[model samples]
Target chain A: MLEKKTHLNLLYDFYHSLLTDKQRQYMELYYYDDLSLGEIAEEFQVSRQAVYEHLKRAEELLHKYESQLQLVAKYEQRQQLLKRMGAILEESSPDLEELKRLVSALKNVD
Target chain B: MLEKKTHLNLLYDFYHSLLTDKQRQYMELYYYDDLSLGEIAEEFQVSRQAVYEHLKRAEELLHKYESQLQLVAKYEQRQQLLKRMGAILEESSPDLEELKRLVSALKNVD
Candidate 1:
């Protein structure tokens, strides 16, 4: 199983824009900002269960979008390829700092 | 104003997965498959106006998603950078076919 934080982070990266303002806010608080459900509920003046349910629905929507699009998967593959290419470049010229910088630029592209 | 075909193509690329089956079908037929609205309406047993409305809504949703995310913008930027890098690589070593291939691979990502 994917780690919860890792999965939520990738999903938020890919589909946060598609989510409603409330969903995005909750996700940002719960996942990226590291707030607990009770804390989020108190912040929003909602029940803890309501906050949990909202997060669950947001996750399901993100999963549905990802299943259809595979953008996150493609991003991960590109990142892996860039890392491998960086390794090759390092082997060819350990002192080529410019090449390393270029590789880093390409890898961080998203 | 952006050309209608070009705008639709980028919108489709970025948000097609978020559309309904009917909306996706209408868009694919009109933008990608080059079918006229009337022809698409006939194929789907809907009126031309209905088909046009569906395509319009799909375009609007795509634009909304894009406005929030800017995925298409980022993709175009990456392509431009890749082309620039390719030019530099070509100037450095015109006979480096492997490097050219790698540049092509990076450019066609997505």
Candidate 2:
């Protein structure tokens, strides 16, 4: 079971890395643009099943990448750090020096 | 310039994929957990420079992945899709049938 999970993760990562422009566009339209599958299918002049397949593949790719590299996990961590830094900055605490030091450390991250 | 950018991208991706547990931990503590470099250095019983170097390497890794595979970009796209789907669901539009189809499509992604 662990091995299967690991395999799925690797596959997700590779698929995520390999998405083409069209796949990305379709994803944006269907998910973000709030288009229905039928709407998307009509826009692309493809069958609903074809649109479904593309989305499924894209999701799989994202999962694969997450399992293998944990990119999303890391990104979320960074975002949390940014939020903490923002809070610290707002508080005007005596620990401002420490915050600055923390900021400098983060500067080295990206 | 493009070549340089591409090189950076590749390096970032490779580094991101290769982060060790120690490196990831350091990243989480310093960036997400809001630890100061001095604090992190003390915790790890290492020099500040060593900590900085680890962070620098990790940031390089993330940027490398962004450049090569655009994982972050894709994740953002997915998040947007989810949000849109949520919005559509909230509206209870006549397109709900399409929304159902879209949901089915997204299910295929994972």
Q: Give the winner by TM-score.
A: 1
DockQ per model, Cα: 0.23, 0.05
| Per-residue lDDT of candidate 2, residues A18-78 (tens digit) | 5767777777786557799899999889999999998888876677566776655555554
TM-score of each: 0.75, 0.43
Tens digit per residue, CA lDDT, model 2, B41-82: 999899999999998888766775667665545544444544
Residue B38 accuracy (lDDT) in model 2: 95
Instruction: Report the C-alpha displacement of residue A85, candidate 2, in angstroms.
Output: 2.1
Docking class of 1: incorrect
**Clash count (model 1, backbone only):** 0
CAPRI-style grade of the A/B interface in model 2: incorrect
